[model samples]
Target: MAKAKWRSVDGIVLLNKPIGLSSNQALQRVRRLFQAAKAGHTGALDPLATGMLPLCLGEATKFSQYLLDADKRYLTCIQLGKRTTTGDREGDILTEESVPSLSDESLESILDGFRGEIEQIPPMYSALKHEGKPLYEYARQGIVIERKRRRVTISNLTLVSRTADTLTLDIQCSKGTYIRTIGEDIGEALGCGAHLHSLHRISTAGYSPENMMTMEEFEAISEQGYEALDAHLLPMDTAVEYFTKVDLPETDTMNMMFGRTIPSPVSLDNGTVVRMFDQGTQRFLGLGQIKGTMLRPFRLVNTSEFSL
Candidate 1:
């Protein structure tokens, strides 16, 4: 059997992650299809969740943190009257109760309490670490660790739909906001008890959910040719689109390539992050920060990596 050829690839692919696969599982599948030498996911979705899982390839990996730290939106279905150990469908049913009458006004009132900023204790079955091991590892061993409350902002949270046993919600919140915890907390507030019935990330980091392609779609594209696959990949600059952009002259860009801080062409506030491009060719040169009225290279792209 011949070995598959994997080369450097630089771009972002918006993957509509399917259920039954962990975030890493989905990333690996996409990476293999691209024959990418390096890749990473912006954020991890639970095996039971399905949603936008952005895959960063090669040079794009350097900017993945911006996506991770960016705000996210999700559509979640919360099942009332039952609570699970893992807070989602994957866990054992821990408690059950009769669901209360869910009227629009009452539900809105309950949800209003969760809007804006609120404190939440991270779930036991989470990837967060304690002493260098994932919290889920200890959770699997039936060890309960006291977790500190984290403050998260829910910019938008509205009831999308509701049934006798379930409530659907559209939520836009800051990064690190756990949808499962929201469902469980809402259920608790209603005296019905609750667990996450389903979750789908609608968007993240200003990337359109409409651009997300499913695994099946990716497989079909792979059959067409590398060109077809490359067409779907967004440029690495899109990863840091939130940052201000500045173009440096050829000589200054050359200095930047060597990690030198060049004078900002225009005055910029200290700590302002900017994406740099070559003034003449306009090719992306990576990112920089304005510190002490100078543009200091934060992360520079190595265009030579793709020469192979």
Candidate 2:
């Protein structure tokens, strides 16, 4: 029998993506740096935006779905008196309006209108799928389609600063919320149209930008004879840290590795997500769903250790 190729350690990388590069481009660079067989990012950020981008490698990719639903936070600057085709500075200026002079009190009042739940129509220049194709495809052909409004919650919206033509804001919003649209809406409320000039994602879920690393820094260290960068990599179970923990005995662990459900030692009446660990060795088995006394297999991690 031939031996399988051994890959490096598996985990997640919190990349502080630089501006002017797409998310996929950044992912490819990191993948090549690590010589990893598989890698995936939790979400996508636009080329013009920079911030905390979580890149999942190896088994960590299995948990990317959980991070996608997590909340995000951003700081953006919107230029009033101008509207762009792409709702951002990268697009051509389509229309221009006179800047309305307003006091800080007036601006704060307008921001208060967007503090709660609201519906927003996604911009045409997004990666949203329509009829099995991306919306950006239609946009490149100068075609615009009517987008439906999606309900999103804005947990926090504050005017950090304001100038004569640009308004800077700090916002914490739910998943799928668009800061570009919020900039446009704020302009409309203030009687002047606006467009996003700059955006920086400060955090995702609970992961902050302060913990991210730049591509340049990562590349520099790799070139200096560093073999393993796994120290900075977060464990796959880090995403599901909010879930409950369950330890299984040898028999139960063996049954689970064979794709069998077994009784759990802990009694969780309410359905809950749990991280399973081996009782003797304390090794991560995978994630499971607990209901009453039964633990059903959700995602098995030690599949390689067992044969069907």
Estimate candidate 1's RMSD in Å.
2.0
Each candidate's lDDT (Cα)?
0.91, 0.85
**What's the lDDT for residue 11 in model 2?**
83
In model 2, the Cα lDDT at residue 187 comes to 82
- Model 1 stretches astray by more than 4 angstroms: 1-4, 305-308
lDDT tens digits, residues 1-308, model 1?
Answer: 12269987789999999999999999999999999999999988999999999999988999999999999999999999999989998889999999998678888999999999998999999989999998999999999999999999999998898889998999999988999999999999999799999999999898999999999999998988788898999999998887888988888978888889999986878998899998888889899998887889889999553211
Clashing pairs in 1: none
lDDT digits (tens) for residues 1-308 of candidate 2 = 22234365578889999999899999998877776778888888999999889998888888898888898999999999888889999989988889888888878888998988999999898989899888889999999889999999999998898889998999999999989999999988978799999999898879867789999987876664325466678878887778888888888988888778789777786477789888887777789887677888898774575432
Give the number of the best model, judged by TM-score: 1
